[model samples]
Target: VERRIFTSKMWSLWRYGILLIIMVTPSHQQELSSQVLLDNISRIVDSRLAILDMRMNNIGSQLNDVANQDEKLMVRLSNNLEDKLAELEKKLLYNLEVKLSAIEEKFPNNLEERLSAIEDKLPTNLEEKLSAIEDKLPTNLEEKLSAIEDKLPTNLEEKLSAIEDKLPTNLEEKLSAIEDKLPTNLEEKLSAIEDKLPTNLEEKLSAIEDKLPTNLEENLSAIEDKLPTNLEEKLSAIEDKLPTNLEEKLSAIEDKLPTNLEENLSVIEEKLLSHMEENINQEDRIQGVNEMKMNIESMEENIIAAMNRSSVLLQKAGSTRCPEAEGFFMSSGLSRQCFKFFMDIERSWDSAVSKCLAEGLVLAEPYDPVMVKNYIATKYGMTGWTWINGRGSGSYITWQRSEGHIMSDIPYWYSGQPGSSTSSSHCLLLMTRQYHMKNYPTQAFYANTCTSKYYTLCELLME
Candidate 1:
């Protein structure tokens, strides 16, 4: 590479020297000198290129030697070559810059532009070579070098500090002045929030102060009565769910309260406030809530009975019914126990049963047909059907009853009734007060599809 560079420099200098000679030559010798100079320059270029070809041949031989080496040695050799090539590239760039600078210094006005142009073109290859070097650098080494560069202070902090030092110390005062320039209402709103801070805190503190003594006594008594077995057990189970210091603080307060009730109450109040703030999260609290719900559900029967009895006396005469045999006997004429007729509400047979069950009742059972017929015809002002708790299943039709076999023996069908082909229409309903030409009884029962929505009649069996 050095030999090639030397040859290139020699060729440039020789050409320049020849041009200078030609310029200084007498006019009569100029043409001959120019022709001779051209031929000499051509011969020099050919010889230099031939030398370069020979050097390339030597380089090829070295490459073949490198290729025949062991893998580890080849790797080491390749790494060394890369390092040397990078150094060479750096030296070349430096030399080129120095030469350009020297040329500019010698002919500042005439050659500065030319020097700059050369400098600009020099970077095209340099950049590509530098990229190759960077690609060959060890990944860890590159990362560490990048980290070092980052760590090297860029004076940003110093500049920021200088800028900050130039700023006025009375910046807050200036801000307050700007705030004062705001509209009066906005300022007033902000002032109101600021002014209420103390009052709000004072109110909260006063509330806590007022409740402290009572709460302390109550908590102490509660701890004594509830703590030993139940609370302690529960505390153990849910210790992780509570604040770590809560049980300890409670125990401490409990121990101190008896001897120093008034004195320690303030401490207890503070602890209690903190404890209240650090409530068990919803997930933990929900566990206890679920347990309580299950307990409440277990007493659902008793609760429903209580609710029913609570509302029983409030019902007007003839509306309330007494438990009689398999059903309730209402003064309104044999309304079944737990049976309620809803004029406005209509539901399918299944839904009607569910609705009744939800209200501690079931759908009305048509046990006493004459009584049911009398109740239905009298009560309803319309001719719509009322669902009853009678369903036909296969050959053995059944009706809902508390006891005793179904009243299948009864001959209460309206003419061609129970409809022999009523495979799908099995649910029974009472047809009330119809005014058709056939003169069929208004209190007739019919077999209809169970899914049909009609006026619901619900029965509530008395406990």
Candidate 2:
């Protein structure tokens, strides 16, 4: 192999080198002078160019032959390649087609032949037989029947022909007569349904079972429950013809019950409401509400008066009040509670209170009964209330305005008891209701009620 390669390389070099030498040796030299030799070399170069063009044409022809031979390889590789091509085609089909088969398929052979093949697969007997039945249907019914006929299973044509022979003549007139005579009496309708009891009802019901809604069986079962003792055997005989489960049949029976029951129930509710309104006096209820409000306000004023006296005593106690902050008010405040910000966060309740004190608010303490009532009203609006430790008598819980120390004074426990749940919802909160404590807003999951041990709001004479 080594010798063969070396010999081949040398031979190629020799062949090319000789051709080059021949081209360089003047091909058209006439007089052996400098100018003539140059002219001869130019002629030789032209000859070499012609040969190069011929060689290139031969290489191109060879390449075309090689490409033709590769066509066989394409077929062998087609297993994987065809699958990839089909995948691409399916994607394209999905993009373009509302129904893919219509886009993906190609018609083969004659259109009439294809149509004939398809028809051959269908139930020949039924299609031909349906003509007589179709003649009996209403105009609109005929059209709908034709549309449905196209979709049924292939054997339908034969079965339909057999059924056609069994049907009564004058079908259209009979249907119209039946529609016009729809039962004026309940007993008549029930009797009609029983009289028409088909001999092949079991087979018919079995065929229809898959199409019936689940409620049908349930309705039938319920009818069984209400059936009179005298009619038990008769009803059971009919029930045995049903195809569905007991529950579904009972449901179907109830659904078919007369509409009179619904109308009667509506009439009863309206009558009851009319009677209730006639028995009650509207004026008495209004008078009771106004009296309760007047009493509460009077009690509230008395408590406020006492708080003023306590404020005077605190002044006399010589506790130096710091200069009032920007929003500070020594007197009663506007009704709305405002939000405040504290820069520092602390771990413990006592530390939080100290932080609030530094910021010029007190752990809120209510001074008077009105204050207690107001606080009660406020906490109800909030999720819960916790007693922030502060100074106050039963009359009022007052926030020491200078720094957070004084707390609101209010004692409120639900009339019955405290309820701690599975997670030990131990602490009590006074969730302030929207209309004082009367309207309770349901708490959201994340609304943590204030606890005594938790960080709480400080009432400030705000800056």
Candidate 2 displacement at residue 430 in angstroms: 5.1
- Please give the TM-score that candidate 1 achieves against the real structure: 0.27
Candidate 1: lDDT over CA atoms?
0.56
How far out, in Å, is residue 167 in model 1? 99
RMSD of 1: 34.5
Q: Each candidate: RMSD to true structure? A: 34.5, 30.7
- Separate clash counts for every candidate: 6, 61
TM-score of each: 0.27, 0.21
> Which is the leading candidate under TM-score?
1
lDDT of 1 at 110: 41
The residue pairs in collision within model 1 are: 328-337, 338-459, 338-460, 339-458, 339-459, 339-460
For residue 319, what is the lDDT in candidate 2?
45
